[model samples]
Target: MFAVAAAAGQTVRNAAQRQLTQTLGTVGATHVRFLFGFPFAVVFLALVVAWTGTPPPRPPAGFWPWVASGALTQIVATALMLAAMGERSFLVVIAYTKTEPVQVALFGLVVLGDAVTLPMAAAILVATAGVVLMSLRPGQTASRPGETAGGGARPMLLGLGSAALFALSAVGYRGAIISLPTDFVTAASTTLCVALAIQSVLLSGWLALRDPPVLIAVLRAWRPSLLAGFMGALASQLWFLAFALTAAANVRTVALVEVLFAQGVSRFAFGQRSTARELLGIALIVAGVVLLLWVH
Candidate 1:
């Protein structure tokens, strides 16, 4: 449930951020998610604490390292994603990142000792293959037949690098949550607030020092930025909760629904027509999600 809801909200958030990339550019748009979302994260934390009547827990020696790693990597990941969208269609860029589930599984196992059962591993591969297909455009090839084509090698690299960074971030956040020794709601909410705080400050500092105009533009576009920020914060809150409940692998694999969501968006919002291959890719994604849910 958490993964599903996160996927839905995230699809909207990604759309907003990607569109803002046109006006704000990559760096400026990337800052929107963190800088604006931080306030919402704080509110979420406040609400969580008030409802539960529990103060935020004291972080252990290891907590900051984990959360900070997540925060920093996520900042880079969002930048890479927006840059990749510049290379290809938004849906294809999104599909490329679906590969994160496999990396997340490996990272979670090694970093946090989260076991990946065979069924879950199969689901990851199946869903990832579907995404690989979703990324293709007919008659576009890279030196050979049956190969995935990109705008260039650079865009492919950007998408893949984004996937790796996102995977690492997911593992880091989960590691932080596990180290907390608190209930899922409090742990997830508190961790989100801190992670956003770190990302917000760091990104704001970079913009202020190196790209003041972009920073100012981000502020000027406050209305749209605020929507992006709220949707991003809501999606992340749900993602953190999902991370607390199970392996990051499970959450991301199921989050493949975002691909289907993107398909709908591309069709309706952008008036893009889908090819047969892309439709099949969407089906495989659904089937993979169903299989994962069934086995688990």
Candidate 2:
């Protein structure tokens, strides 16, 4: 349930951030998620603390590294994703990012020592292939086998890089959350608060020093940016809760449903229709998701 909510919220957040990107650029738009979201994160943490009647746990020596990695990598990943949006169709960009589940499986194994069963691995592969198929354009392979359909290698590379970084971020956040010796809600909320603080500070400082006007623009567009921030924070909180309960691979694999949500948005909101290949890809993704749930 948390995963479902997170996926839905993330779909909305992505749309809001994408719109902001046109005016603020990638870095500024990325900053909006962290900077504007920090207050909401704080409120969430406070609510958890108030309800539980316990303070946030003090991090051990190892916690900072994991949380820091999560924070930093997520910022970069979001920037890369927003940058990719500028170069490709929204659906194509999202399809490329759906590769995160496969990458997350590998990263989770290496970083958090999470085990992947054969069925889970197969599901990841199937879903990844589906996303790759969706990324291709009609007659793309026949005309230019080496290059991507609409754009060249750059957009593809950007999307793949974003996927990889997001995978790492997920593993890192899960590692951080599980390391805490507290209840899941408290631990997840605390980790979220700290991660958002780190991201907000780092991005805010960078923007202040490098691109002041973008910061101003973010302030000017505060209404939509605030909504985007709230949605982003809500999604992150739910994601952390899901991570606390399950493997990052499982969480991310299920989160592929976000692609379907993105497709819906593309079609109805943007009047972009899915091709036959894309529809086939969506079917494969659904099959993979169903198999994954059944196996689990």
| Span of 10 residues, lowest total lDDT, candidate 1 | 141-150
lDDT of 1 by residue, 1-296 (tens): 89999999999898889889999987888788888998999999999999999889999989999999999898889889878777654555665687899999999999889998888888888888888898765665454343355455566678888999999999999999988978989999999999988988898898899989999999999998998999999999999999999999999999988888988998998999988888888888888888889888
Residue-wise lDDT of candidate 2 within 4-80, one digit each (tens)?
78999999998889889898887788788888899999999999999999899999988999999999999889888
lDDT of each: 0.87, 0.87
Evaluated at residue 270, the lDDT of candidate 1 is 90
Top candidate (TM-score): 1
Give the C-alpha miss distance for residue 260 in model 2, angstroms: 1.1
RMSD of each: 3.0, 2.8
Clashes per candidate (backbone, < 3 Å): 0, 0
Q: List runs of model 1 lying over 4 Å from the truth.
A: 80-95, 141-154
